[model samples]
Target: MKRRDFILTAAAASGALALSPVAATAAPMVFTPGVVAKELAAGKTVFLDFKASWCSTCAAQERVIAALKAANPAYEQNISFVDVDWDDYGRHEFTKSLNIPRRSTLVVLKGDQELGRIVAQTGESEIKALMDTALNAATM
Candidate 1:
């Protein structure tokens, strides 16, 4: 498939070719797994990354995540990183699952309470801050 000129907003996703129930159906983005929920309930911290394949911001964030993961093995071990596919990812259902109307939404949840959410922005520093916050929450 041709790369989209730009990452589409969740509003634009209803018309996304990949999201078509006809041509194809995308898998939902799962930032945190069931285990994460359980761990968080047990006082663990979890970081869920809601992203898409066509989103340029997601691609850039991937680099930052790689570096972060490499820099801190403890972060990798202590925190659970869940990558939820946003684009074409099970339209409507997944959208509702997020309870949000947009893609590129990064949410940090301490158990069930959300610490922070980043939407429609690609600032690495800000994203890093949110991730850091989530990691801290898991331990707290």
Candidate 2:
């Protein structure tokens, strides 16, 4: 193959990869209490991610949430993710009020109603299903 042809092929491949699923990443979660309360009051699907920076399961769940949201962009509009940093904000009054048992816990709620809860779950399918429960509940 010609050098110019090789360069063109590589550029095209890189562009395709950029548009692929491998480039998909989860969106950032909300960390503000006032925003969370406002979203809930507005009847949005709320996801409380009780996480610590040092927790592996929390990291995995974060990835799973991102991938799911990437596949279903509607989740961005319908779901409001509130990340509760157990390492920094563990003793915060709102954290205490949520009654999170441990780090890496995911609590899904629609307004005031609890939809589903998962603790230290790393399975992508299971995590997506759990999130789907919240999505399904939100539509109803």
Candidate 3:
């Protein structure tokens, strides 16, 4: 193979590897119309991530969330993480009922109460705190 071709292939391989974590990470359930209500009724803490594929803020928050969950397995073990694709459900009543202002919103709900929320915020600490809240509520 040509030197240039070899370099390009190496770079592409590295890029793919870097993205493997996001792919390999346990994915949250895609939100269906009544999934949230069902989970909440079952006494599970729900972590709702309202995101769009094209949103950079959502991507950032996802990275932070993935890292946090990897660091602490309890978050995933205790909470039900659901991905609400903004493109699909952004205008749906479920979102409107929650008053989600926009994509990149992260909400933690337990029972009939909202435990915590973060909107368009991607700081590691902030995301971790929200996860912690969900964990606490889940274990309570």
Candidate 4:
């Protein structure tokens, strides 16, 4: 194969890899609080949901939270969880702190590292899986 051809092929392969899923979207720091910051510093896992009053999705997400807790009492009990009020008085502070564009975000972090996130999805099972993965990763 010609050297020039090889170089062109390599460049195309690299570009495609960059466009792949894992490389395409790095996790966004949509929500992070002081308490959550502390937990992460201690290598603890935080599973939090950011929501506002007007978003119907937030209300439904709350139900998912309830069901998740009921199903995994042990995990629910151990995980450090909190809700950021993106609706009212706390809105500006949270949005500024996390550089969040909108509400209805779920963030999982261990200190400064984010494992995964669920965006524009309402599957209860999938959300729990992401939460559990973060919780499980923190322990390891």
Best lDDT among the predictions, by candidate number: 3
Give the TM-scores of the predictions, in the order they appear: 0.63, 0.80, 0.83, 0.66
Indicate the TM-score of model 1.
Answer: 0.63
Off by over 4 Å in 1: 1-36, 88-97
Look at candidate 4 and tell me the lDDT of residue 54: 77
Q: How many backbone clashes does candidate 2 have?
A: 1
Which of candidates 1 and 3 reaches a greater lDDT? 3
lDDT by candidate, in order shown: 0.63, 0.80, 0.93, 0.68
Q: In model 2, where is the ten-residue run with the lowest total lDDT?
A: 21-30
- The residue pairs found clashing in candidate 1 are 26-88, 29-84, 29-85, 30-84, 45-138
Query: Worst 10-residue stretch by lDDT in candidate 4?
Result: 22-31
Candidate 4 stretches with Cα past 4 Å from truth are: 1-33, 89-94
Cα lDDT, model 1, residue 119? 77
- Per-residue CA lDDT of model 1 for 6-82, tens digit only, reads 44554477567655433342222354335455756777666666677887877777666666655655566566666
Q: Which residue pairs of candidate 4 clash?
A: 40-111
Tens digit of per-residue lDDT, candidate 3, span 1-140:
99999999999999898777455568899999999999999999999999999999999999899988877778888999999999999999999999999999999999999988999999999999999999989998
Candidates sorted by lDDT, descending order? 3, 2, 4, 1
Question: Model 4 Cα displacement at 9 (Å)?
Answer: 77
> Which candidate tops TM-score?
3
Record all residue pairs in model 3 with backbone atoms less than 3 Å apart, i.e. clashing.
Answer: none
